[model samples]
Target: MITSQTLRQESEQPRKCFVVGPIGDPHAAHGSPEREAYEHHLGIFEQVIAPACEKYGITAVRADGIAHAGDINEQICRHVVESHLVVADVSSGNPNVMYELGLRHITGKPTIHIGEAGQLPFDIASIRTIRYQRTRSHLAGARKEIESALEVGLRDGFELLTPARVLRGLQSGDGPASVSEIGDGANREDEDSPGLLDDFAVIEDGLDDMTADMEAITKTIETIGSLTEQSGAEMLDLSEANVPMNARLAAVARYAETISAPAGELNTVAAAFAERMVTMDSGVRAALGLIEMTPPDERGEGTEEFLEQLMSLDEAAQESLAQICSFGTSAGEMARMSRYLRKPVKEISAAVQQLTSAITRMGEWAAKARALAHSSAT
Candidate 1:
C-alpha cells in the first residue's frame, strides 16, 4: 500500500523554471520595424537574460518569434501563467503584446517590461520601463540592464512569489483597500478585494463537501460487506439440500429401466433398482443433514435456488443412469429367455438410443440453468 508519506516525498522533487517571450510578427523575424524591435530584445535576452539565469541554474525558454497556427492570445496566456517570469517587449504597443502583459500583471508574477526609448505606451507610462535606442550601443546597454534586472528578480525569491500570496496579503481581512495601499498607483487593489474573499469562501465550502462525501462512501462499503456475508450463508444451506434430489433422480432412472424391459427380465431389473435405491437414499440423507447444519446468515443470495436446480439435474442424471443399467439387465434376461421368439434387434437398439438422447438433453438443460443461477448470485 502507498502511504501519504510516500506521496509527499514524490511531490517534493524540484521542477525547472519556465520563461516566456513573444515569437511571431515579421518585424521580430525579418528586418522590419517589428523585426528591429524583436532583434534588439533578442540580443538582450541571449547575451544577458540567458547567461544570468544559467549562472543561477535556472532554465530559460524564449517564446519570441515562435510561429503557431492556433490562437496566439490563448497560447501566450498559457505560457505566461506557466512561466516563472515574463520578459515582455512593449516597444510596438501591439494589442496582443499588451493583452499578454496584462495577464502577467494579473498573475502577480515577476515581470520585467522593456521597450525602445519612444515606443512605450502612454497607458503603462507609469511603469518603470527600461529604455533602449535602436543602435547596437544602446542594444548592448539594454542587455546589461535586463541582465541586472533578471539577477535581482531571480534572487528576490521565486518560491513565495505567486498570485495567491499577493492576494492573501492584499486582503488580510484588514478592511477594503486597493493595490495603491501597497504603493501601486493603479486601483487594481480595490478591484481584487471582493473577489479574493469570494475565492477563499468557495475553497472552504469545497473542503466541507469533500469531507461529507468521504463519510458517505465509508458507510456504503460497510453495507456491501454485510450483504456479501449474508449471501454466503444462504449459498451454504442450498449446497446441503442437494443430496436428496440426487437420490430421487436415481430412483426415477431405475423405474424407467424396469418399465422398458421385457417381462422375463423383470427380476434382474428389480434387483439392480433395489441396490441403486439403497445407495441414493443414504447419500440424500447425508446431504440433508449438511444443509440443516448451515447457519442462516451465512447463506448467500440465490443459493437455495441454485442448489434446487443442481439437485434437480443430479436427480435427472441418476435416473438416466439407473434406467440404462436396468435396461441392460432386462435385455440380458430377454436374450436368454426370448431366444426362441427371436425378438427384433432393431427395436431393442431404437429403445436404447431414445433413452440415451433424453438423458443427454436433460443434462444440457441443467448445466445452462446452473450457470445462470451462479451468475445472478454473484
Candidate 2:
C-alpha cells in the first residue's frame, strides 16, 4: 500500500499552519489603543505560534502577514479551508475569527484552539483549548502544548470535533460514530462532497454566532445608555449650582472621555457583526438558490427540517433587526449629543457614527434575509 509517489509527495512539501485571530486595525497609529492590541497579537504569534510550528517543519502564516496581493477575505478563507493545520486564538471571541474558525471546523481538519485564560466563549468551551495568561511562562506552556498536540495529531491523524462529527454522522444516516469510523479519510471525503445539510449547517452556525453577538451588543448599548443618563443628571446638577461655563464644559468633556472607550468597543463589535451579516446574506442567498433549483418532489430527505430551521432563523433575524434599529437610534442620538458639547469629543462622535453605520448595514442584511425566507416559504 505504501507507494513511492505517496512517499515522495509526503517528503517534498512542508505543511502550513494558518494562524487565525484578531490582527487588530492595520492602520491604527503607534501608541494608540488599537495599535497596542495589534502589537499584542503579533507578540503571541512570534512568541507562541511561530516557534511551535517551526519545530514541526510547518510554516505558519497569519492573515495580515500574507504577501500576495488579492482579496484579503478570499485569501483568508482559502487558507482556512486548505491549510494542513489551523491555530485559532479565540481569546476575545472576535466575530471574524470565529467565522473563519467555523469554516475550518466544517472541514474536520487539524485545528488547535488557544485562548487567554478566563476569556473562552461558552459556545466552544467544551472543545479542548490551550489556555494561557499574558505571562512569559504561560506563553511558553501554550507553545509546548501546541507542539505536543501537533505531534500527536500529525502522527496518528486528527479526529473531527464534536459539531462537525455529529453533523457528518447525521448526513450519513447514522448516529454519531466512533473516531475510527468518522476520522481521517471519511472526514476528508465529507469535506470534498458536502451535502445540502452541510451547507445548512454553516448557515445555522453563523446564525448562532450572530445571535450571541446581538445579545452582547444589546448589553453594551444598555450600559452606554446608563452612563449617558447618569452623566446627564450630573451635568444638570452642576448647572443648577451656578457652576462656571468653563467648569460645566470641562465636566462635559470629561463625560465624553468616560464614554469614549465603550463607544469605541461598540464600533469594533458592530463592524465585526456587519462582516458576519454579509456572510450570512450570501449564505442565505446560496441556500435559497439551491432550494429553488430542486424540484419540490425531488427536494430529498431533510427538506422539511431545512425549511423549519429557516423559519426559525427568520424569526431570530426579525428580532435582531428590531434590536439593531433601536441601537442605531440610541447611537445616533448619542453622536448628536456629543457633537453639541462645548468641547466636542471627536473620538466618541466618530465611534458612534461608525457603530450606527454598521447597524444600518446589518438592518439591510436582516431585511434581505427576511425577503429570502418569505420567497422560499411561498
Candidate 3:
C-alpha cells in the first residue's frame, strides 16, 4: 500500500477537498446514546478516514474543529461553499450532519454518503451507504471502500451533486428548490460572461505577486538592520580607543545612519502593506458570504445583484492582500538589517520584536485570504 506521506503529496497536487462527519457529540457530556454515536463516528474519522485521506492525496478537514463554538455551523457553511466535494456520513441520522450534508447537496458539489451497516436512517435509506462491520478486521475493507467511493464521487463532477432533493433538504421550512433554480437561472445568464471568472483570477494572481514581493523586501530590511547594529557595537568599542580609532568610529556611525534611513522607509512601506492586507481580508470574507449583507427579504432583492456584489468584494480583497504581500517583503528586509546592525542592545531588541510581529501578521493574513478565495472559487 502507498504510504501516508505519498498520499499527502498527491493530494497536495490537487486542491479539491471534502468535509466529513462531526468530531464530537455534545450529548456525550450528558452520557447519552447520541454521545456514543458521536464517538463511534469520530473513530471512523480518526482511525479510518484520516488515514485514507493520507493515502489518496485528499485533504479532509472535519467540522469538529470549527464546531466547538456556535461558529461550527458557519464553518460548515464555508466548507460547503468552498470545497469541490463533500462526503457525509449519515449512519445515525445525526441532525447536524444531515443539515450540513443537505447544504452540500444544494450547492451542487459532488457528494458521497456512507453509513455503518444496519444503521441507515429511514429518510435516506434509498441512498446507498457503504456497509462496514465495526471491527478491527473490517478496517482494511472499510478503507478500500471509502477510497473507491471518493474516487467515483469526484469523477462524477459537481453538477450531478446538486440534485433538487438535496437542495430541498437544505431549504428553510421545507421550501422547494426555488433558490437553487433561481441560482441556476442566474448562472445561465452569466454563462457567456467570462469576465467575472477572469477578473477574479487576475486579482488572485496580483495578490500572489504582492505576497512574494513583500517577503523579499522584508528579508532585505532585516539584513540591513543586522549590519547597522553590528557596526554600532564596533563603533562603541572604537570610541574607547585612541584618536585614529575614534575617527573610524565617527565614519562608522555616519555609514550606519545612512543605511538605516532606507530601512526606516521600508518599515513605513511594510506598515502600509499591512493596512491593505487587513482590507483584503475583510473584502474576501464579505465576498464569501461569511459577512452578512442586506437581508434576502429586502426590497429589490435579486441573485444577480448579490453575485455582483460578491464578485466586487472578492476583487477588492484580492487587491488588499496583494498590498499586504508588498509590505511584508519590505519588512523582511528591515528585519535582516536589524540582525546585521549590532546597534545598542535595546534598539536591536525592539526592532527584532517589530520584525517578528510583522512577519507573523503577514503569514496569518495570507492564510486567511487564501482560504477565503479558495472557498469561493470551489
Which candidate has the highest TM-score of all? 2
Candidate 1 achieves a global lDDT of 0.46
Which candidate order results from sorting by lDDT in descending order? 2, 3, 1
Off by over 4 Å in 3: 1-16, 26-35, 67-70, 153-159, 162-189, 192-378
Report the Cα lDDT for residue 232, model 3: 59
Which is the leading candidate under lDDT?
A: 2
* Full ranking by TM-score: 2, 3, 1
Determine which window of 10 residues in candidate 3 has minimal summed lDDT.
177-186
Candidate achieving higher TM-score, 1 or 2: 2
Instruction: Give the alpha carbon lDDT tens digit for every residue of 101-175 in model 2.
Output: 777766566788999999898878999999999999999999999988766665555656765665454343434
Predicted structure 2, TM vs. truth: 0.54
lDDT of 1 by residue, 275-317 (tens): 3333232222222222223343444443354345434645644
After superposing candidate 2, which stretches have Cα over 4 Å from the reference? 1-11, 170-378
Look at candidate 1 and tell me the lDDT of residue 366.
49
| TM-score versus the correct structure, for each prediction | 0.35, 0.54, 0.41
Clash count for candidate 2 is 0
